[model samples]
Target chain A: MTSSHLVYLIALPLFSSAFLILMGRKADKWGHIFATLISAAVFGVGVSEFMAMHSRAGDMRAVTQHLFSWISVGTFQVDASLLLDQLSICFVLLISGVGTLIHIYSIAYMSHDKDRRRFFAYLNFFIAAMLLLVLGDSYLNLYVGWEGVGLASYLLIGFWNQKPTYATAAKKAFVANRVGDVGLSLAIMIAFAQFGSVTFDGVKAGVHGASPAALTALGAMLLLAAAGKSAQFPLQSWLGDAMAGPTPVSALIHAATMVTAGVYLITRSNFIFDGSSTARLLVVIVGGITLLFGALIGTAKDDIKKALAASTMSQIGYMILASGLGPVGYAIAIMHLLTHGFFKAGMFLGAGSVMHGMDDEVNMRRYGAIGKVMPITFATFGLGYLAIIGVPPFAGFYSKDKIIEIAFNAGGTKGIILGGATLLGAAITAFYMTRLMVMTFAGSKRWDDKAHPHESPVLMWLPMVVLAIGSVATGFLFNSGNSLVNWLAPVLNPNNVESGSELMKPIVVSSLALLAVILGVALAVTKYRTVPVEAPEDVSIFTKVARRDLLQDAFNETVLMRPGQILTAGLVKTDYFAIDGLVRLIGAVVSGTSTFLRRIQNGYVRSYALIMVIGALALIATIWVVTL
Target chain B: MDISNYLYLSAILFTIGAIGVVVRRNAIVVFMCVELMLNAANLAFVTFSRINGNLDGQVASFFTMVVAACEVVVGLAIIVTMYRSRRSASVDDASLLKR
Candidate 1:
């Protein structure tokens, strides 16, 4: 039963996919229902697991369900075990819970689409992959999940392959992901060679004896992998372009599951991150840098989903920053993870509703004022907005507030700067989100004749409503000592747990931050409201710098994207000349050799046998003479 | 003839036949030359078995002759097919075998 549970996280979707595919032509038509039910059941399993673990809070150790031994030859062995520890359990719950909501949301969002069954299939596979990612107790299994999500992201991003941009966007994602995969594969090899183990438990238990130099090298390489996966710094620009996918795909896989895999990987291997001070510092600095960059870019983005994509990057930055801090790191990190999931899902779905109505147009300037038209979407969107900007009584407020407090109390100027930057980033998040809300839902309808705005179907709205309720209420439930982390505490080391700021500091700082959020919303209310102002065609200078997507666009365009194009072009030209010339030379040589060989083949058998005898005698004489 | 000397002579003869098969252009000649090499090797085996006072080697040589005869039959059938198709017995013209 235990072994089967581990494979269930991986095989169930795969098994169902076979069934769904065999049922083929009809399977896709009814696929969304089965897919959604499967994910929801997985969520039920996660919740039940949490409760089961909760009921047994007296246990101090983790749950190690050994599925089987994956590899064992000589001294090397890696298990196919599934671990239920404090960290994995927290993410298992988050992935399944949020995954179900996204699946349900997709039901109606994709209801009207052609090839809807294929969409459901990809979505189900993605959930299974993400589950495997959190559940796998070994590096090899985790890598499978990592690549699985990458494959899913590519498929979903290019779901509408007819659109050249979507296909290109998918290509860009796959290529950029390959760069990160190289770093991850390299680090895996290094860990295997140095520590002789790739399993989580083996690596954690054994790596303490490894040379600090090797540890630092391995840590830096892992950080590089994490950066590319999490969309920090150099790779941050791809997520913005990844918005070329469907709105729901942009919401779940791109914004939530796929992008966060990097952070999750780093957090899961905290023993490595915590051991190397240099590596932890690198995580904080890169995370802080990416956060500041993502927030600023979001402020200047015009497309609602694009802006939200930028916002997701910035929010993930806070979580990455949490991984760099002390014992409290995992709790604060997962808080941001959960809250961000709810609000970001809401925001993207809300964008979908607007796009649904406006014939899929995402320009903010062209949209204005329709709160009454989409009361459910707007209200849920509003609640989501408050949660995102860290308004009081909303989920983001508590989580973001805790992370910021942890950052400040981390006791350095760097900590203070990160805290302040995170706070200001929240304000900007509010500014952009309010700008979005006011532009889309606050005024009279400004849609063109081809566009007729209407409410999304029940399937879409139901998830929005559900996420809205979670966004509004989850923070309170967490704050009352009934937090998700408490549920996770049974499998953790008590000494390392954050016990999360039972002090006045978090309250004071958070209340002030909430006030700042309101002020931001107030500013947006004043500015974007109908003054008949023409929006700037070019960003104002400071905002333009921000809009260069934190110089990520600039970096990638210069270092990666543009260079790649040039190298490809150069290779094409080289192939035309060098390869063609070489091939022609080979052709000339072959003709020359064939004619020469043909000359030797005059057909006298007696002469050929005489030549053969003479040649053999001469060879024997030559060998005997040389030795003498 | 003493078996050891006869074996060496047969080996040399077989080497000559193989060379002829490789260097000759006429398909019929190359086919006959390959058969000569197989016969020469079989002769060596039969002579060595008589010298060693053993019947097993002679038996193996007998089986080898049967296998070689079958190969010749199959090889001739293929060559005849090619000859019929193209009306030529030039081995170089039959370029289908990449090797």
Candidate 2:
């Protein structure tokens, strides 16, 4: 296929977004269908592009579509271009394919809303932006897509803007992302200064010759950017609150597509990370800490979406940690990323289905024995849960377990620490996820009288079922022949590292992971299966802190927010009392002088003539004095 | 016959016209005094032309005369309109600009 066809992948959604927005409420009747069709067409184009690239031999698998000269200065140039390579192709398929499903899901999820058309428009906009992000040839172009998705996410998260808290949540997400964006912007600037190019290929080729310190700086800054987008540690406070958005938004932007941009970025820039051990270790550290942090918070969240949101953060943390493990970890990170997309989106959609049946109620404590009422949701959510906890034969097992095995093989004290952390993360993941499942589906009925639980429409359950199947089978398929790893070999593992290294036997790792899962499940089932419906008012300090997201809010307040508030207040005072007062003083001086000067006019021709004569005399006297 | 004498006579007439413009209350009288200043400037221009042995100053005086005639037309029209409105010709009485 010609590289020009790549435009269709980006243009389809962009055009649909423009169409939906321009048509406004007039297209409400058919907007969702139009958006879904456009997304499906984009997915078809993505599949065809993948096939075309696959048919090509070796390096030719990567194609660049040069649109125009974007920027040009002496010895510096960037093109408006798109690259259809093995790595980007994966993202394109994931975004468009999964995006189409979410679009279909949103149709049913948002059907009752008055502004559903606008929501669909924003979804299309998001897909277009995400497509731009993965497909862009340069860092600058990618940034365009990056900010585009940010705006789209901001719009989607506040889709129900009538709620003040929802709007605030949207603002919070946007602001947190902006913090990371600054890091990305600086990274690009430093990259240009160091290598004189911001193109992915240019940087990858040039990065090896660069100073290790520079490479480490680049990698660290990139990690910060990833942390913001993927909701990693320190920047994670926004993800749980982002649950205030519509469920489809949580499923698509938060769980599936947008959040994975960070993983894609680190994986795309693998060359830089490969060169700098310090940078790689930093990536691992961020990932490791965030995984534990998110999982701990997940264990305490009562809101179903927020629980899933925390789970999403922890899962992304795993992917980030994996990406930090060097070449072997990059491929595995992407593998986990793809599988996580399927299962997380499925699980979030399942959460939406429950809320739909339970009169939009979100508290998991209020949900019980829902499995009997909505078997499809329970079954899909159960598959996703099993996948997430790394149960054998499920998608997460192949991807996540590989990461753990690789972490163990990383060697010495660091390896053991990383491995142990990942294992602990896994057990905690299984525990919290199991608690969520039991509290939501398996226990005695705790639903209020008003909620009449029922199966969602076929439209909603259909996507969940598809994603659930993906959650079950994708891991085995991808890991079995090393097909995914091989397909991605040209871009990700150019040296073709043999994919068989385990510090411990494969059976041992799998057994250990399975043991953790079983123990977690057993612990949760015993504790929560017969527990009271309402959350107990009194809890341990740890639980309280975890419930408050490990005091992240208070920390943010003390560290970032409070100082910002005080600084703003100080500036406001200075503006009012000092700067503004000075301005007022100048105004008073001018007015007072003008009032005094007004007497000189006196409204008489004789006075004006006399003043002009006196001014002329003064000028003449000055000139005469100077001449003398 | 000496050019300096004409320059001195022009300067004295210009000063007298300036004082008349400043002291006079009647708009017609002030207008006449402004014309006198223009004539005085014309005299000085002619004297400078003779002293410098050039026709440039004489040419400038002609241009000034044309401009002064245009200014008279515009100024008299404004004065006539103001007089018609307020029924007064004294320069002090036409001080509608006083705040």
Residue A593, model 2: Cα distance from true site in angstroms: 3.7
- Candidate 2: the clashing residue pairs are none
Candidate with the greatest DockQ versus the true structure: 2
lDDT of 1 by residue, A343-363 (tens): 888878889988887888898
Per-residue alpha-carbon lDDT of candidate 2 for residues A362-424, written as tens digits (9 for 90 to 100): 998898999999999999999999999999899999999998888887878888899898998
* The best candidate in terms of lDDT: 2
Q: Which residue runs does candidate 2 get wrong by more than 4 Å?
A: A497-502, A597-628, B1-99
Instruction: Give the DockQ (2 decimals) of all models.
Output: 0.03, 0.58
Interface RMSD of the candidates, in order: 7.8, 1.0
- Native-referenced Cα lDDT, model 2: 0.92
